[model samples]
Target: MALAHILIVEDDAEISGPLERFLRINGLATTAIASAEDAASVLASDEIDLVLLDLMLPGEDGLALCRRLSAANGPRIIMLTALSEPTDRVVGLELGADDYICKPFDLRELLARIRAVLRRPLPAQGRPRQTEAAYRFSGFAFFPQRRFLRSPAGLRVPLTGAEADLLLAFCQHPREVLSRDTLISLTRGEGFAIAVRSVDILVSRLRRKLANDDLAAEIIRTVRSDGYVFQPRVLAE
Candidate 1:
């Protein structure tokens, strides 16, 4: 079997150099790049499995790169940020990054996060066949079995695997207020471990995509301090 190919997108040689060596030593194929431009080139020409992206880079910033990746059927992304950058982390998650680790992060913890993300299923990648029908709401069509969303404008709206999971949950229970913890459980199940805050971020990301068209207004609505409600009455087709 081919080893997992990881792309390390950090401008800091001090960090990327050691990270590359460490991941390679742990039986992963590692490629290190300095800029988001070079990282985009590598991603275009390489079959990378995951990306360890840094927010600060020369020229194009990591958040912009992450947004581009979110729109593409691309590899998973995990951001690397400073310890004081909580806002960046939330923004990264809103941009569809799979995970992130604070700078000065423990190598072991980062490695563990990498392993966890690698093990998680990607959207529409070899999933088992399902009898569930496609969902139609607000002129948008979501085929859960295929793991893709089609807009009313007949364009394919890009969605991360995590976003797909969360959308599935909302479709399954439309008009119901789904709390953060309930959403985490519904999307990931009991064994799936993720922070409740992640659920909120993912909802924000999904809402952004769902509201891509001005005609499709208020598909999802926040329920004050409770959770959130999927407003449109979804119908299974």
Candidate 2:
């Protein structure tokens, strides 16, 4: 298999240097850029599988760059920010980032997120037949290949990488109540004990995006002791 190319877009030499070196040591091809413009140039020239984007750039901000990248076909982005606020993370997710990592992070944690993102089977590369290309569940249509969701009202719902992975995990095993430990291990591609709150956070975000704010049980339902379940009748396409 070809080495996955990664682009590191950060103005801080301290952060970017370590990131580049670590990725290289792990068998990934990496290009580090000091500014958003340089990052864009690298993106235009390379086949980057993933991007590590700093929120505070010299010229164009990370949010603006994220929007621009999302508008076109681009690499999966993992936003790097000093901001640890939930709102900040949610905003990044809404803007199409695959994941977000706060500053003063562990290299191992970042590697876990990278592995999780890469583990997602891209439909363009052809996935297993057991996993459907598209699924219709209740009034929501899920296209795993595109990481998209459509409501009954025909409005499109955006999904972050983590959200998509969680949903896909559940959909792949419908009606089964997955344990929190199993969820963390499976969805994250790491056995590290992540806060169960993170799973709750992703579920909450998906529920809101799916218009299940009232807790109507439109799609996902949380069990008291077990875990969450994809409640809709799923039809494979």
Candidate 3:
């Protein structure tokens, strides 16, 4: 399973705070929001897996947000509220909610529902939208899913996980010099200990891969005394 990030859109502090903590403790990332407006902003800027929404929210209600979010291929929505009325559940379902659970619900059951919803197919939508998809640049495409590079002629080139990881960092921050320390922190945790020279070596291997057919000069450039910069503007596909 992918690293799941949950967006909690509940007005109640008592509900949102503990729910966020609990989900985080169970190895999931979370963003807590109190209003539908903030939730919309988060959805646009971040990749969310499932949204845990409270029906009775301040300002625009959860049903409204669910309709707006679910109109296209988007994250899975699971409505949460104290309202157990049949009509409320029906309306929420009609608005494209994947599941609905009454508030004051058990955490275990809630987690199970989240996992179930993530496991099922999103109908014709295929996989949930991810922030890191294929990064295309200078007639080369890098697919993180299969850890392979596609040449301009559509030839498959293999990539090591380490190479792919560093390539992703460069793609994310193109045309900017990234210090060796910064690249280490982006690819590995803060605690990981590797010399700065090793980072240069890794960059060399990846540089050779991008230098396919002897065009590596246009792919990555080294800024003397600084770090490296991805010379191409990447297009995500």
List the candidate numbers ranked by lDDT, top first.
1, 2, 3
TM-score for candidate 2, please give it: 0.81
- Tens-digit lDDT string for candidate 3 (95-145): 667667897988977887777656543322345656546889888888665
Candidates' C-alpha lDDT: 0.81, 0.79, 0.78
Q: Give the poorly placed runs of model 3, Cα more than 4 Å off.
A: 122-237
Per-residue C-alpha lDDT of model 1 across residues 1-237, encoded as one tens digit per residue: 139899999999999998998898888899999998998789878878899999889999999998888777578898998744667677787787878888888787788778777765555544566565789988899986446899999998877767877888899899999988788767655544566777776887788888754663688899988999998889987
The true-versus-predicted C-alpha distance at residue 30 of model 1, in Å, is 1.6
Off by over 4 Å in 2: 71-73, 85-87, 123-132, 153-155, 212-217
**Local error of candidate 2 at residue 4 (angstroms):** 0.5
Counted clashes in each candidate structure: 0, 0, 0
What's the TM-score of each model vs. the native? Answer: 0.72, 0.81, 0.52
lDDT of 1 at 170: 93
- Leading candidate by TM-score: 2
What residue pairs clash in candidate 3, if any at all?
none
Give the better candidate number (1 or 2) by lDDT. 1
Error of 2 at 128 (Å): 16
Of 1 and 3, the candidate ahead on TM-score is: 1
Residue 70 accuracy (lDDT) in model 3? 64
